[model samples]
Target: MSKVEDAVAADAATLGAMQINAFDANQPEPLFVEPYAVTGWATFIQRAASSRSGPQARVGVIRDDSGNVIVQGSRHSLTCLLHIARDNDAAADLYGPWQESWGAPPPDMSKDRLDAFFGEMKAQHKAVMGNVPHICTFIFPKSRGGGGWLTAPMTDLEIIMTHSTARGRGYGMALLQWSNEMADGFGLPLYLDAGEDVVGLYTRVGYVRQPDELRTSKSLVPMVRAAVKV
Candidate 1:
């Protein structure tokens, strides 16, 4: 296999090991119990690595010297990162324009209206879907540096739980440490988003909460139609 392919294989092996460890230790439910999880994560890794974009993605798997897999983690470009800004103008713009253009009318709530609403929603969904993989990586990295002088260039992290039996062995920490080493190697600041429950985990590792990010969704049929015609 090519070097890149070898790396990917090694990474996948690490992920499998990590998952198996987590499962055995009863840390939490595994993200994927069936074949879907393994296939899905593999697809994501391949796509990210092949993409021609600014945020180059990479997957790292920990393995034994004999090439046995142990744990896995991934990183993606920062542009895909999503932040729910406290005062997000883009979201407001997307919904506000539509809400103002189409007032509350029965026809506005009719089947056609519903169709348009769904259409707009689909478009927004597509836009966001394109951003999910990369942003997800940024939010789940192993280590994040400080805001100013300590910042590093390679800043995104996403830890992948490939197996359930691999938890409680510090594999997660190892992945984060690996990512941090990459960031430090490149001299950049690391950043990630955490769910409310996992915020403490990140804090313990030097991640602090930024301003609370919010999300708003609204119907955008009229705007989309107008753009399409233009």
Candidate 2:
């Protein structure tokens, strides 16, 4: 089929599938996902903010009685990443400063040049429906790691976050419990990589660290929550 035909088919497939994956207290018009996979509720703030035009990933969210977003989480498919990857400026804005904060300098590449690079990769990496479950979560070696490589999870629980005002009210636990249930229903393990400071929180939620998992410069350690029979 032609590229336009392929895009139309893909979007149609995503629509029906999106309903089954909805994860939120109140849907976000289309769908709602919790903001981020937050641990250590004590450290409720994400120091760095990444700018992006919009997210192409699946998201879940929790809200207070007043209709405010209290918690959030998300999972990105390969197709989602491909779009963001094509939108290099958005990707850079979203992650560039986060990389810089880790003592790694930002790339010197021009915006056009960077887009061309990812455009090449987008052309090369064609994702089938089956690959959606295992999406890219973290890029190894980091931008500062001097290697530009991405590592995907078998099933990713990408980002979970809770607002400071909403912490200690059981929102974090609730969101995580929901995540567990969702994974169990899918019969796929939920995977994530965490930093040393917040590892305890995940451990409490049944995330077990693999011995082979190592921390990169960003200090991410791999952990997984096996699918449970619901």
Candidate 3:
């Protein structure tokens, strides 16, 4: 069985190609333009693997015996001390210095719409998690009279993908289980944005919809899994 390991910069190229194959190539409406996708993902992985500090991001890969990456995943966590702005400038406020890494927007993707989507996501998060230790939560703090603050930090699962040929071998679930185990080690809740088609899968794994969630035109669903005691 393939086991998860830290993805090094050398794995960036394969991860990039796999990203396009898993997310863009098969989609009816491609999220990334084909011409720029590979380099874009490569650059992203390279930078993340290099700094190892930015956003505390980490990438993992499961490789076949032949040493080809068959599945990839990335995750990060926000510490309790960081403060996120809740206003329209939230994204800019939190990520302005790192904007250069954002690169150019694809021609098929609308810059304004994308920005608006992120802006709305921030808004929803702020409403439900004002000054919380993390962006994700297990309960509605406001409804519970906790004044919109989660009890602790949460781990965010940013991306997970398995190569097409590797599907149905339980690779995706293995990666997800690895993520859950990691979060459980830290006793932090797990959060992710799930595509519409995979909502059932996430649900089966203990993730529940966020309160007052924001659904994208693409049917993205926001979910949070409560932390399991180690």
The lDDT of model 2 is 0.34
- In model 1, which regions exceed 4 Å deviation? 1-7, 10-36, 44-51, 70-154, 213-230
Q: Residue 145 in model 2: shift from native, Å?
A: 26
What TM-score number comes out for model 3?
0.64
Best by TM-score: 3
TM-scores for the candidates? 0.43, 0.41, 0.64
Better of 1 and 3 by lDDT: 3
Question: Candidate 3: where is the Cα deviation over 4 Å?
Answer: 26-30, 43-54, 70-101, 106-131, 134-154, 212-218
lDDT by residue (tens digit), candidate 2, 83-105: 12223333333233222321222
Put down candidate 3 lDDT per residue, 3-68, tens digits, no spaces.
777676676666656555555554465555544545554565565456433233445566666655
Report the C-alpha lDDT of model 1 over 1-230, residue by residue, as the tens digit. Answer: 10111235335433433333433234243323323324434544564458433344456554544554533343211111111111223223322332322233343134454356434433443343222221112222222221100111113343333333333455545554555445554444444433344455545554544432221223111010000111
Q: Provide the overall lDDT of each model, using Cα atoms, as 2-decimal numbers.
A: 0.34, 0.34, 0.48
Best by lDDT: 3
Task: Return the TM-score for candidate 1, rounded to 2 decimals.
Answer: 0.43
lDDT of 2 at 198: 54
What global local distance difference test value does model 3 have? 0.48
Give residue 189's error in model 3 in angstroms: 1.7
